[model samples]
Target: MYYKYPNGDEIYNVMAVYEAHEVYGIPRINDDEGLELRYFSLDEPIEELNPFTEYYLRKAGYINKW
Candidate 1:
């Protein structure tokens, strides 16, 4: 996932999001008519994140640091 720098020109990946998908899970809605819906929310409850998670803080490292 990537965030826009207000102007929508700058974009970058946010590892926390990727990790959340692997760890917790993302809500998915499946349709039988050859259509699939995958829902993703960036608003994560603070408690959902690992306390030891230092991605938001580290800034330098957002991958597995969380």
Candidate 2:
């Protein structure tokens, strides 16, 4: 899955989708994707994600205000 940032930068392979709390279970791979990633807490529900992640999550059928 490919997605674009708000600045119009494009990213290839949006990677895997997992439940928010399950994120830690995901393996840490090399920086092959070249993305600068940061962890956010879905438990908070009030936190907002970057546009690209939000868009990808929505397209993947994950619905949340953030």
Candidate 3:
């Protein structure tokens, strides 16, 4: 997914998934920066994730049994 900030900056390749805490969260994709990304509740939309993020999530078994 892509997050367009109010300042016109864009964050690409975002991913959102369910967490063990029973909430949805967006993990940090920037390993080098060690950024703590945002988290969204179940009410939020997670279907807007990017292709690369989806592939990695699936491969890592974050989501399965499709």
Q: Give lDDT: candidate 2, residue 9.
A: 100
RMSD in angstroms, candidate 3? 9.6
Residue pairs with backbone atoms closer than 3 Å in model 2 (clashes): none
Off by over 4 Å in 2: 1-16, 20-46, 64-66
**RMSD of each candidate relative to the true structure:** 11.7, 5.9, 9.6
Arrange candidates by TM-score, descending.
Answer: 3, 2, 1
Clash totals, every prediction: 0, 0, 1
Per-residue lDDT value at 30 in model 2? 81
Per-model lDDT? 0.47, 0.62, 0.62
Model 2, 1-66: lDDT tens per residue?
A: 576899999978645655655455545558797565556554354255566667776777574555
Model 3 spans > 4 angstroms off: 1-45
Clashing pairs in 1: none
For model 1, the local distance difference test gives 0.47
| TM-score to native of every candidate shown | 0.19, 0.33, 0.34
Better of 1 and 2 by lDDT: 2
Which residue window of length 10 is worst by lDDT in model 3?
36-45
TM for candidate 2 is 0.33
CA displacement after TM-score superposition, residue 31 of candidate 3 (Å):
18
Residues 1-66 of candidate 1 have per-residue lDDT tens digits of: 455676668665534335344545655656666454343334433445544444553454443322
